[model samples]
Target chain A: MEMLMNPSQMTKKYFTPGVMLVSLIALNGLIFLALRLIFGVGAITNLDNQHPWGIWIGIDVAAGVALAAGGFTTAALGHIMHREEYEVVIRPALLTALLGYTFVALSVAIDLGRWYSIWHPLIFWNGNSVLFEVGICVMIYVSVLYIEFLPIVTKKFIGNVRFKGMLAKLNSPVDKLLRMLDRGLDKTMFIFIIAGVVLSCLHQSSLGTLMVIAGPKMHPLWQTPILPLLFLISAICVGFPMVIMESLIASRSFKLKPEMHVLSKLGSYIGPMLGIYLAFKVIDILIREAFVYLMVLSTESVMFSIEIIFGIILPMRLFFSKVVRESPLGIFIASMLVILGVVLNRLNNFIVAYNPPYATTSYFPSIGEISVTLGFVCIEVLMYRLIVKYFPIISIPEKAGVFKTKYSIQGSK
Target chain B: MATQGRRDFLKSLSAIGISTIGVAGITPSITKASPENILSKDRMGVLVDTTVCIGCRKCEWACKNAHDMPSGSIDDYENESVFDNKRRPDYSALTVVNKYQNDKTGSPINVKVQCMHCDQPACVSACIVGAFSKKENGSVVWDESKCIGCRYCMVACPFQIPSFDYHKALEPEIRKCDFCFDRTAEGKLPACIEICPVEAITYGRREDLVQVAQEKIKNYPERYNNHILGETEVGGTSWMYMAGVDFKNLDFPTLGDKSAPGVSESIQHGIFSYFVPPVALYALLGGVMWISKNRDKKEEN
Candidate 1:
């Protein structure tokens, strides 16, 4: 395995003929976004007064934010927990989070009717509103994430190029700016890291608070006084799994051996975190007596059962097994299930469980809505590929044996 | 005595530290008083006597006309075919009248359906941008300029009264019964109150209306149901209803006396009370950072 110091040294192929499908999906999404802007939300969406928010809030913003939990969780484990062994996966996770949040902000703009008034939350403070908290935290957190990523940018750009023409005169100043930024970040990076984690916690839980205000509108199965706690816990549980899944998938895509040793240990943390989440969930149900509704075999009941059993409990059990953790495929499948569980939980809270009594019919996302969501996802993937190809986001090994399954098994144990 | 004094001093220190943390947590919530807009005692309201409504649909005609919406000829609103389906107040129609049979008398009980304009309105509390407000005149009004059209108000309203102009391409407003804020401001009754041929609706101070409703129910126990529709449900709406038939049969939701925003507001404010929980969380995180840094030094050595 070979490691390239600069992104320019990596392959710069734009198309492989196989990526046409992705490109086409992204194009369709871009067209629908244009339609939404020109004709208004009514022209392109199946959204009515009853269903004010659709897949844009549920899938694109809510689930997208939860999926990005890998960044903060891995940062805590590696930097805060001083787990040097987990450092291999932290940069990729951080990059994923930065891109993830950028798209969430973009998705919120698309979802708003008056997209231009997106900055209202910043200036006109509604401190009582959970959404106000979410908006402010996200705005600040995005800035913090970029600031955290600056050292990487400076490291890549400094001393690499001496520009010519008009650029030649500015080259020394640019180099000086990078050096200053790099130096400043080295001393103060921990403060931003701490702030990032704090901000993430505030917003992730506040997302649940948004749903909590729906109160009677949300079905009892999903609605609870501790909804904010549930949301925060589920996000924390999924964070490590997300990091593991991304690392494994990236290794496979880049034709490098998978980081099974670090990932399996990461998998071990999921079981305990998942245990804490499940305990709260069961207690919440019992305390509320919502278990009665779960017995009716209705859509909410069935969907809730699938979310808990297949997405959570099944994967949690898988993570506990030593053999499952040791095997690359086993850990991947387990992490995927946890990710699916968190995604399902967010979607269910935002859409399925929200039933307006006066609504003439149930809401289903229009093709345009689905396309826009898919387009954002495609953008995340393409951006990740582009950044990883160009930057030193993914750490590489000096020898071939480091990523072997047997090597991982022996090392992790 | 020396040992006892030392123990007492240490106990006092622990108690002081713990109390300081507790004070820090609660001060934020206390200083920033809960944003509960108090409804005025003398606010105006309407008393809707369903037993006397007569199913005329004249209020519907008057409402549309007064709001500058298309009424399509006042005579057209009297068509009986509209009664075949129960209709809600929409963008074009600010109010509607539905007919249901009084179970005991086998007579038609006419019910007027529109925004209740609750004293503690859920829409006002749920709106993120403070677009909805319960006015001094007991009108729950929406400010179009402030509304980002998130439509959270629609979801929050227990009555589901707020309707969006979904068909409009640009500058669509959330259409609802404004309780005739414009007319009432000019010392005129709401269009529905003025247009009722039977004089079934009584418009007055909310406190006076409650007394009037109570006296009527007490006087004609056989003619009216034992309960008032909006008197207590969802923290008492301005529009009170007295009907021969049970409100549930007349399509009124069976909501408790609790205000719609009460439960959600309590839980949200409770968790975030004082901002102490978040501060404690950051402290714990800082502890982790310190521990990890120490661990790193040990490993390096």
Candidate 2:
């Protein structure tokens, strides 16, 4: 597979854009450093005591993690369901997941009041905090992801017979041990899969639970005990659509074959999840008797309606249509809308709808905050590109061995 | 060989089943016991008689002075020109007195806003790093050292009382009224209670505070509203309020008896109490794996 993708051709297509993206990322980082050194968070962020979290927590961390749920969801569908068709899309989903989690971690670091004490969670265990659960789960999951990607790393680096022989001798026992480990991982992968699903459920809901505790401070439109359920379902709803969007974008950007069948099948899962989410959302408002507030058509209500229509209803309609689902551009646009809806939902919950009676201040993200966030995203994409370029993430066909045999004979001649 | 495989499968199945049942049984009891045993005792609290308060910012000023917080100008409080506007507790100001204009009565009612010091405070429950805790004497105290500065407490607080010093580079503690826990511990009233020229703030045991609030309501029927604001709101707040007007006029959140902390904690503990769901999921996966493995074996043959 590596030999087939002529290096010169790959470089000509990818090198310039990759360099430009990296330069933009560096420029963002430089601006962030200036903000950190001179102005402090007060100068650069819209955060106040009343709105301590703002976009960093809402959009970057919470919504970002929810979008990244594609990784586990796709992995589970592919491996657990034995859908070999999904195998082609799994690595890209994993890459997105890795980058999304990385961005979340970065957002957390930026949002912390005492940024230096970030390692306190690992050092001291706070058993009661929902945040403690989030921290531990995210940290462990990040490590688990890297381990999951280790096969790609190893396949990229070790090549020569002498080196391979040395590694083989050293790793033969370890390879057997790893294969045994892989068997154990395969057998118990369901536990981790279920745990990941459950943990994501807990934390995503806890994100809403975090605001539910705000009680009256949280806008009535966003507050409910059922918030956790809404968040969990919404995260799952956004997850597959994000996978579709990411796959389409990455494939086009990398000039790789599009996995349309897998994405279309994923759309089937997404369509129903969005329906269930909207039903619960409407039912929740009705139960809370908050529909009266929507009738007034306030700025908040209009925003809420826009979020629902564009985010859920529009994309959902597109997903159900077979013609649209088959189109790469249509799926990409729907995926973007789903992401937009998730982002807006989180923003409304965390910032827009939080009504601290005494403090009526509205927040807008500072340029520095935006820069840091964008820098993290750029770094994430760069790492994904590098990994995919070097590693055999996309599995080659068994028949490719025949091509390799023929190519070797031609090279000798 | 078939019998042996069946026996092994059954043994695996039973192991999974028994462990799941055991986990399900143990989880609820564990969750119930943990929070119950950790319940704070001798919680110190305040009883505020809104009938007595003159909308004076003395308590607000005294709180800042006692805590060594940055002082807002005295004119900021006294000038009626600025007083009509509602004030919120912020990083600098741990307490605020706001006027609630009642349309029915055609009178302006004053309510001093501060931490409710809920018996089961959501801020305490929400703090995964244990930055916030209910003191035995009833104040919801914050430890800056334990704080990861996540400000989940700010988001968790029902009263919107907890304020984060987001501007500070280091040691940004959540600023809120502690019911003058440090002063109260030394056998003195909180600074707010001490300096209230109108004697609006009363500090005592939570039980006594509720009793005082109820007595005031009972004794002065015309002077006070029928309800004590915190007696049952959010599972009984430590701070009770006796207001001249309805509490809702003052923007007090209409809360139910169940504490927010209890609701979230119950769900957290309920879903994650034991390894039941994971084990069950694993068994289901294992069963699928087994069938697939056998099918592959047959295909090879």
Candidate 3:
């Protein structure tokens, strides 16, 4: 609700010795991205007619969108569900969602053969297409997330309106604009928040619809008519866990006290949602008589088993334990499992179980494809670091003053 | 020619009727018929008699020549070395003839592979920009002008027919058999259909082809298999095949009778049907907002 640290108290250091590794990886990714753009997708990727979509769609778009579910999920929990305690994590979750969606859009752009025509979806209306719904919803939802994020940006610069040199003359107008924007955003914030949540559900489910069209091509274990529902539920189930995971990771990175009290309570919600997802998943498979396929020790069955066992069921079982719920390490592990589970589920749906009937050989992402994906993620992390440092995205704890000055030197969380 | 062009245009106008008939919105599996039949009652189709195919790759050559691609020489295609490995139709080639050894017949059964051009093509439904259309003449064609080259059509096509010009950096096109749409509109047979020496492939109305296929199968039951490939597969395809052996042996996908778009469209349209679910979802969010607002107000008081 308030700025965690004063602008003056914020760390001035932009780079550290440890940042070299991230820079190198990000550089490598950017290079591949350039190669892909110049030489075309065929030069950088193994994708063929048989395997048209690779990791760019599977991990970067589908999984990326699902993992970013924390934004809308936390918004609903903190504001709509009336959970005041989750307010601390809400800013970070929202920030994560904003950056995550941006990356998803960028990844989609690079993946498209005609990247310039990315704007075609905006002008062209193909309502019957599942992807059309996803494209429209994501475009609108990303804009909503940015609008919801505006207050934080305004909070940082609203008061400190002084600009140096030539810009000094226009500072007052800018400041006035910021104040007016802040006030306007305050009254209308609820609408955008509500829209973000609604739009999220639509597009999150529509990602699943993208795969449903590959009905016969997709393996039975992953292909179901209720794929959209499964995708929506899995995304919802992963939301709180993603928030918890992000909070813990950030705390550890910044050497701040883990908000175990707020997070442990968040932990309580995970099991029930996971249980509901599992129930529907099991029921859907059973109804379709697809469970028989799972019994086979084939690649598809093994991946499905790992996804359900290690990803969903394990986390669900772990979260129910009192020790797991109370401890930060326990909760973190459980959250990671849930996150990985959702990631695997998406990968399985879009890639692993997708066996095109006519394909002579299986598809694997080329080095360039993998690099571009990694680069997008690294860029997301770097951007997150930059934004959180500059903007008051993380709420300052009431007792944070004791450890504040020392942690500021350790740099952005 | 102008009247023929107008008739063709009018036929296409009718064929462009997008089918909205799908199963009720709730039951997950809402099946929608492909917009194939909307254009015309007399959609033209091709019927292939696989048993009679000579495994000569002349169809491939003719297809290239008709499309203005370099066919080299007709003699070059006669080299059987190309069929040494099972080759798929690719960027340069629109159609391919594959020779599969039929164990029962003790001879090779040649199958010509091209776009099946479904009555309800999966590509038509999958194209986000509506680049692909199932014409009244039973040709599933894609408009390059409208194509964004997302390659979803490649993924969605059941026959795996649509090939991308991946090598082209600036101008990539989805290359597939368009059922010789331009030639067909000009009242000319497709080059491949005109060039087949043994009459292995027959060009006619789809309904008439089905009847012809049935008559051939009934007359020479020993020579033909009762199963007609693409007759009912994926809600039927414009390109029908009558093979002497199992279609699977010839690289035909074992698809169910249900059309590819049926299951997907059903789920998508059903969920967003009449915009009811999304409106209801928005209402629920609004309700949540109201309750939350009221609780915060009470706390403040």
For model 3 chain A, the run of ten residues with the poorest summed lDDT: A404-413
Preferred candidate (lDDT higher): 1 or 3: 3
> How would the candidate models be sorted by TM-score, starting from the highest?
3, 1, 2
DockQ of each model against the real complex?
0.26, 0.37, 0.27
Q: After superposition, how far is residue A26 of candidate 3 from its true place, in Å?
A: 0.9
Interface RMSD of 2: 7.4
Over the stretch B20-136, how does candidate 1's per-residue lDDT look in tens digits?
477566545432423244567889889999888788888998998899998887788778888888787877888988888766888888889899998877787677666777787
lDDT of 3 by residue, A184-205 (tens): 6665566567678888998899
The TM-score measured for candidate 2 stands at 0.84
Alpha-carbon shift of residue B235 in model 3 (angstroms): 0.9
Q: Candidate 1: what lDDT? A: 0.79
Q: Highest DockQ, which number?
A: 2
Write one digit per residue (lDDT tens) for candidate 1, span A198-271: 88888898888788766677899998878888999999999998888888887777766787877888889999
Q: Give the per-residue lDDT of model 3 (tens digit) for B77-181.
A: 889988788888888899999888888879889999999989878888888877788887889888887788788988788888899877666768898999999
